[model samples]
Target chain A: MSTMAFLKRSPWILHYDASSCNGCDIEVLACLTPLYDVERFGIINTGNPKHADILMITGGINELNRAVVRNLYEQMPEPKVVVAIGICAATGGIFRECYNIAGGVDKIIPVDVYVPGCAARPEMIIDGVVTALSILEEKRAKMTGAAQIKDDARQAAGETT
Target chain B: MTVNEEQTTIGVALEDLTREVKALQTDGYRLVQIGCTDTGGAYEVNYSFDRGYQYRNLRLTVGPETEVPSISDIYWGAFVYENEMHDLFGIPVNGINIDFKGTFIKTAEKYPFSVTRRGGDQCRNA
Candidate 1:
């Protein structure tokens, strides 16, 4: 399949609000609204973990939600992309000094894209999602090539034997 | 009045800060921090900031009996602050929707500051 086709078919994004003040969460919803129109790009929010290709996480991972966040990350299939949304997710924002908070989301899970803003503007979120899509596309290409190369190597070995 | 001008004259009385805030909102002033401090005899209620990050501290003295107007409607951040202030000092902030069910202190009994002095001390008895 063409790279464009590969990108278009990838439908799933899981949005997890770890411990944010609901600012970034609202902005994520705004992206889905008619104004930003993220749906046109084939980016969709998924409820089930198994179906998701991208994980869009908002808020700084606090002590209460850290384990749950990590578990959700582990549940996602390989080649999955994690996008950390807002300043809280990227650097813990104003809540950074609080004892209850565990710094940023990256400390809990590996992040593929970091969207910076106290409550990140919808435009920046879209940019981050697009970046995640690009990263996903690259990974898919590498995986496909690796599988084809492995199959070819096996076929050659079989013929020799 | 814009707080960005270093110091804008806020003509309202300390107790009238809440009313002034309501008026300011009509003229466009976003509420920031609703904090308090214990001033020996009374608790000083402070409503801070004008808009965005620019801050202006307006304080009102409440001596246990006074009920400070809640700014929850103005700034959503004040909900937690009001609850925190209630938990620390037994000051009742009027018109706050959410139950200030103690975020800091667990019990309902009045203990404004730390439990420094306990009645019938074991140390004294010993």
Candidate 2:
């Protein structure tokens, strides 16, 4: 009914692949397939990070790509959610033994939801995204209150001056 | 030629398994690990399941210079692993993306560990 509710329900998402084996990357695309139909749930994959409400990351964070991944996370707008898909993103699966891999994605960004699997199943990824939306809604509510408090503080400061 | 009960586990020749892997249609066994240990100077290559869940480890022995058949056509993942082995051990896998000159070693020279006349003379001079 409300504009805020509509916006919260249909938040745009962006997919980022740090350096995956193409297994998890393909499974992420499977979620958007006609069989699963993630778009029906109001989850749209946006090309630009500025319009994204959630960042779905797939891959084990490596030393080389750590900075690039962090920069992308910073570029996203506030009240954003992060979803780490696949075992590599959650805990660095087979590549964990490799010296170059920097471990899990959470070490670089604040992960809201983690979908664990070598290459997370399509159904599970959809579930994780939906779960992230709920968390984002709660965060949005808190941020709205925080913004109102900041505005009130500014008004009071103007009067005192 | 005949199977012996006492030497069953110890000498169950890997040739039998390799034949089975080659016979497969869609999925095939792929060599995963290949390297030489400092203990006995023996080279070992371990082939495991390339596709499906149920698969067993198959071990094979070859000389340090012997060229092994490539399973890149069956399992695409083998390309990277084979390249890594070539970089570390200098073992060549035939039919592989041979352009994998060297990976982490950062050199285009032939087998760094191999002893040549120049290396021997340098050692003698030293």
Candidate 3:
């Protein structure tokens, strides 16, 4: 029995489009359709960052939205995994030639999983989320250990003060 | 007889664009979109507007050094277009109601749509 075994069972997701063309976005939505129903794995598409266990980003980060991406990432508590959902998110797709297009989601934030494709298929998106779940569980284990160490140090400091 | 839905293009001098846009605004026309194209060190600016059903365009050629007057006075909504023109095309614009200060189409690089390419001299923001 793992310390945070329940945490790995139901990991919520927060979907964001850095600045994509909506192609990958539709595919991500398709994963929620009856055909895919990623929810069977307990992956919930959430709108709130507080409830998000996985941050799924689907576009190249522009300078304007760079701050916005950082803000959402910072809001999500520790032990979270970030999944770059498509080619643009993994590496700014067609817009890479354009003057303003930045490189990838990892250029702005840390990415645990990278799904490759112009518009990644629904199955691949579901697969990426499944991979993200494992990463989230790993991070959660590390985070719990770090929190306990910090609490012990703080308690020691309190005894002296 | 019904009027064709085709858009008509009008070429005007940079000096006369303000006057033409003002007249069109007074005549109940709306400023649609402004498209800027860079060709051989010159900016080919196309200003589109629609009155009721028909759409008209005003075309003008200007150098990158010249500052174009903001059409937001005529149509407040034009501020967005004018701001985009300034941000992308590096077209100097004055007096916008709500200026994004060249943040409209936020790109990785600055003045991305400008005629001044990577080798040439960079613009003010660069």
Winning model by TM-score: 3
Model 2 misplaced regions, further than 4 Å? B1-126
Which residue pairs show backbone clashes in model 2? none
* Candidate 3 residue pairs in backbone clash: none
Best by lDDT: 3
Q: Which structure is stronger by TM-score: 2 or 3?
A: 3
Clashing pairs in 1: none
Q: Tens-digit lDDT track for model 3 on A32-112?
A: 778898777777889999999889899898778889999999999888889998888988988876666777999978999
TM-score per prediction, in order, is 0.56, 0.57, 0.82
lDDT of 1 by residue, B1-126 (tens): 754455443334656766777776786676666666667767777776676645566667667546667777776667877777666565666766675455443322333341221122111101
Rank candidates by DockQ, best first: 3, 2, 1
lDDT of 1 at B36: 69
**Model 1 misses residue A149 by how many Å?**
2.4
Comparing 1 with 3 on DockQ, the higher-scoring candidate is 3
